[model samples]
Target: MTPSESAAAASNDTRTRRSRLLDRVVGSLWPSMALHRATRLMAGGQAIRAFGLFARAARAGSAEAEYQVGRCYLNGAGVPVSRADGFRWIERAAARGHAEAEWILAALYVDGVAPCCDRQDSSGSPLDLFSFDVAPEPDFAAAEKWARRAAEHGSADGQALLGYVLTFGPKSMRDLEEAQHWYKLSAEAGCPQGAYGYGSSLVQSGDSEGDEVRAADYIRLAAQAGLSPAIYLLGMLTERGWGIERDQSAAVQLYRRAAVIGNRSAQTSWGRALMWGVGVEPDRIEGESWLRRAALAGDADAAALIGDIYAEAGALPPNYAEAAIWYRRAAEAGHAAAARTLGLLYLSGTGVGRDPREAMNWLGIAAEAGDRSAQVDLASLLLNDGASHPGDLAKARDWLERAAASGNLLAASHLGVCLLEGIGMDREERLALQWLHQAAREVVSAQYWYGRALSEGRGIEADPSLGRAWVARAAAAGMADAEAALAEMMVNGRGGPKDHGAALDLFERAAAKGHVGAMYALGMMRDGGFDVASDHAAALRWFEAAAERGHEAAQHIVGHSPQQNVRDDR
Candidate 1:
């Protein structure tokens, strides 16, 4: 190289160093100018040059520049990510009364981490970075302290965050009224999250209808701003006509909008609408796709609904195995109906192995959650297996009583039978009769038992005529026991005048239903020639039929009669 050229290069290097030194001196005296240039550079995507200017302004004690440097360090924007250094710089800016720094500091304390800068929009404003990550530990007290300071400094985002903390924090720190106050301020300042929070609070307040209307308006504002939760809630209000005109089609559209943005509740609602053709054309495949997405996102209700779709016999054959899988997922998530259905599946071995213990465990969970049907089913299981498990009879009675008190007729009938027969407890004739009568209005078995009790004068004064009428009602409904009992009453004239022809007819009807007692009675009438001309062959056949069914008297007659030997020879 020529010597002159090398000298010129050294001189240019000296000039460039002198120029940079002069610029730094000027920037120290006028930090705002440096900040402006840094912002411009950042807008142009020159992150390294922007960071250099921001650091120079921060060295000159500019609070905004200090915040910018902290954000760059935290977000790794042309700087190595360092949470400690970022926090220190942000604290310095916050202490110097930078409103944005105070807001960010409060958010850091609330979440125990910096908000992700990569989630910002094109305008460089943070989006909903509230739920992205969790901290090893959170400092709610510190968060509240900084948030209050930021809100007092008139930061709208700070006000909204303060409202959120107060509304959902620990019980001792929660203050709904205070939260509402901040939420209103933030909402008035154009914060969509604040609008949504305030609207939700008003909806749940149970105040006047006017408050609900106001809530709907606020929620609409948030929804227009593209808040997914607000959109979902507005859809619910629209569908139910709560503070809004009912429009199912519009509600479904709203659900679709929110669902597309990843709102799990909205996805579930939209899936249900599509599957059931509610305000939409039925599309089971598409509906199931949406539901699966929600279920994968940990939506218990969506999982249960998917289970129902598989279990129900519809356009496609029921898939019990798939239903059981979804039901188990929902059940593990505390879905009461899913637990009950899973219990039934286990009990019946429909999709899983038959496991009485597992069925009882799941059914007990549902019953304890106040499921009336589960209570009755659990009681029935206990009663059926009472002999195998000690104390099961008492537990069954308790469960039946609980279900009966909740207006379950099947439970009432079972409870009455247990009391009447002293199957689980001491007989309570009056209580048994009362329960039996109550259930008899709808339960055929209860009708038969109540009628038998009245005829025997077991609980109340014998009303033979009323007993005969009740038994007739049960018999007409095809109760085998009632038919046999009514026929005996007719033959003995216990309730009405004796009628041999009617008694014979009743006996034949009851015998056709496989009633062993009726078979024995028919054999007796034929053998004694009490109702018709003596027919020894028919009597022997009836006795044999009854004997095969374990009727003791019929067995004795068939075994000892010489006519039996003649019949066998024939």
Candidate 2:
């Protein structure tokens, strides 16, 4: 070797020896170091040395050191994993009142992380180290005991976990009231899960201490802490203006945020907003995809919403088949609206084959489930002659009565008609008239009936003038019966001075709608020269047309009085 090469070799050997001496010094000092410094060493990649330090400190009765060593063993960090060693160290820290350690020990017991077993010799002889020869199962009683200790030690997370276990643990251990008490304490201590649990319970109880404001405040705190469920609930409250100012835009943003975190309910809300263009641009495909995601996640409302979207003829070309598919899905999930809609589809054969029996079955299900629309439809079906069992007027009346009592206007009208005709129940003229009057406020048929009754003094005082006005309103609303009735009233001047021209116009209008009575009246007017110049040919043609439609009066006049000028005025 030359002189420079020899000096370089000596320099490298000196540096190597110095590095080994520094490592030995550091490794030797680790066992005596404080927990924080040891943790920093572990963080700085001296895992082997830090593990030794934690073990030594734990043996010296340091609770934090024991907990760190236990956690490391549980996670197989810088040491071969040992469940028995982890439990022992964790229990030691817990015995020393280490809050997190108690919580971890409770979790270990609850999750059966390390089942206790006898340490037997290789000769299969039972060891005296522990009592049991077999592995011990999970002990929730032990978990609860340790969890209470942790909670009493002022661990917010421990209190929250204890609250959860008390509320949703095994049935034998559940205690909702106590759970709420713990949750309140944990939430006051600033635990996010505790805040969420307490807030959710309050919201579900309809009113918290008879005020929504307190519930909303807690929920807002949890939401601010980035809790997904709390965010979703706040969005709902914002959208509905419940304990908050209604803001569709803000609700949409919240729902979007929660949806990004995989909240199924928020996904459904976002999808519905997108589909309906409520605070969002309409995106049919994307909205439908999200809806499908929620439905697949078991949201019955999402399935029903999908059905409604497909059923709306204005929004999309009606796809009744697809609508039925989704409606059935929701129906199976006990959605009353979906069942009612499916029943209607069956009745009209819009999507499925027309099956009265199936329609009645579904309608019955919805009606019994308290769907007012379904009750009315089921009553109508029963009143008609097409039901599986020949029309059961008695049952139909009962259903109608139930629906009417529930404020169903159409059901009231049907009940009135039934009472008037004595078709189902015993006749009750006064009750029938009352129902007719109420129904006449909106329904054209009810208006016509009420007007006719008033004009004829049936079950009410005669009010021909008001009756004629009501009939006129119905006629303007395109009721053929009202038109024919008004035409006769005009011809007789029962309500006011009659105009023959107006009578003729009303007769023509009613006749054009295939009103048989209007046709007969028109023939009588033409033959008598009351409205126009007597045209026997036109009168005969009117008579023949009415007779062809099975009008008995028209048939009689056409056969017996072909050329006779017959005019009857009463």
lDDT of 1 by residue, 472-558 (tens): 888889888888888888888988887767777788898998999999988988887575667787888999999999999999999
Q: In terms of lDDT, which candidate is strongest? A: 1
Q: Estimate the TM-score for candidate 1.
A: 0.74
Whole-model lDDT values for every prediction: 0.87, 0.82
Candidate 2 local lDDT, 11-115, one digit each (tens): 999997895565455545554455665688789987766787787777767899999999888888889877777888998899999999998888777776555
Each model's TM-score? 0.74, 0.64
lDDT of 2 at 439: 87
Instruction: Please identify model 2 stretches exceeding 4 Å from their true place.
Output: 1-194, 204-211, 224-227, 244-246, 314-316, 384-407, 497-500, 514-516, 519-530, 533-570
